[model samples]
Target: MAHTTDETLTVLVYSDDRNTREQVRTALGRRPAADLPELDYLECATTPAVLRALEKGGVDLCVLDGEAVPVGGLGLGRQLKDEIYGCPPVLVLIGRPQDSWLAAWSRADAAISRPVDPVALAEAAATLLRSRTAGRAPATR
Candidate 1:
């Protein structure tokens, strides 16, 4: 089943490697599930680029690359959770399956392993977005 969003869901993918970022974009673009309309990916290859994009204010979810050299996605995810107000749910891609625990430690909403699976990634993204959308409240604290 193809994924389709009710409204456009802006996804931010953070990876230092150009190929990894492109791979993610390709995965998302290929087959949007029935749930989410075609995904709109905002790709970022640097920490500052991710932050800068967020500041402009259109991201609905975040997919981060945990294996990125230097500053990894786990660290980036944690930083966004801490610094960004109402930080969006984060999905981290761990190159090592063993590091799934680390993804939990980073408090990521969900994760996908590297050598990515387009279907799984799309499903996970859709699930997380649906859960988040369903959890919204009236802003009364």
Candidate 2:
């Protein structure tokens, strides 16, 4: 992904579990690898909140939990892709690695299995940000 000095990519993380969201935030804060730059994250606990936030502000990437209540990340990801134009790239967290194909079906750009590895989460987020900067439309409409 091509990046500029002034660019601060925004990531929206959606999960029903507060602790899971915290883990993602902490990992992102660390900026594990030297290759990927630091970014800002907007956390959302519910689907409606996610929509409202996107309407109020723009985002570069989204990290969604497949197990979230009401609407799982994969389902939400697909809905966003279909309903929104130029949705940001999505990074989904499936319950297991076996569901990778399901993630693909949802049109998620990338996915990782839970429990998440800190380094993997950071890498995935960076990759999504890079993809966003590279002209890929975001998954949110």
Best lDDT among the predictions, by candidate number: 2
With candidate 2 superimposed using the best TM-score fit, by how many Å does residue 5's alpha carbon deviate from the native? 7.3
Quote model 1's TM-score.
0.84
How well does candidate 2 score on lDDT at residue 71?
A: 91
What C-alpha lDDT do the candidate models reach, one value each? 0.80, 0.81
For model 1, the stretches where C-alpha displacement exceeds 4 angstroms are 1-6, 135-141
Worst 10 residues of 2 by lDDT: 132-141
Give per-residue CA lDDT, model 1, range 1-141, as digits (tens): 233334466788888888998888888783356655456778888889989988877677899999887889998998898899978889999987898999988889998998899988878887877765564421111
Candidate 2 structure quality by residue, lDDT tens digits, 36-125: 445677889999998887776578888999999989999999988887787888889999999999899999999989998888988787
Which stretches in model 2 have alpha-carbon errors above 4 Å?
Answer: 1-6, 30-37, 135-141
